[model samples]
Target: MEPESYYFLEHRQDLWTFIRRNPEWYRYLTRDTERINEIDQLAKQYFGKTIPQRLEKAQHNIQLVRMLIDMAGAFRD
Candidate 1:
């Protein structure tokens, strides 16, 4: 099956909490080295965007991934 993205309803609240608390750390943990390399190869796709905007997108992706992991753990409980 395809992996879930933003699939855990229960983790939404906690995800928001962590994001609000430490956005930078949240993003650092969620970074996709491979995709980052791809984006670096073509930053023109996201040119004119501020660092904050880029960080927000990365953070959102990270939070969604984390939420899915948390949901899987909960499911196993």
Candidate 2:
């Protein structure tokens, strides 16, 4: 086994989870353990764990509320 693969099996549960969740990156990540952090970022992005995604979701919710309020106002009028 490659040293990196062994290291992954022995010491990196987070990376293992990342791999399990995103199998497409398995080969690339296993071949280059140096990219583990990059994979971590990808996982955050994929699962909407990043600030930008969260903010976007929040903004969308705000817009939805504003639209609903406007519709309610129109009904009141």
| Candidate topping lDDT | 2
User: TM per model?
Assistant: 0.36, 0.61
lDDT of 2 by residue, 1-70 (tens): 3676657545766656777777877787657767767877877887787999999999999999999999
Q: What C-alpha lDDT do the candidate models reach, one value each?
A: 0.50, 0.76
**Candidate 2: where is the Cα deviation over 4 Å?**
1-18
- What is every candidate's alpha-carbon RMSD to the true fold? 19.7, 4.1
TM-score of 2: 0.61
lDDT tens readout by residue for model 1, 35-72: 33343323333352557777888999999999999999
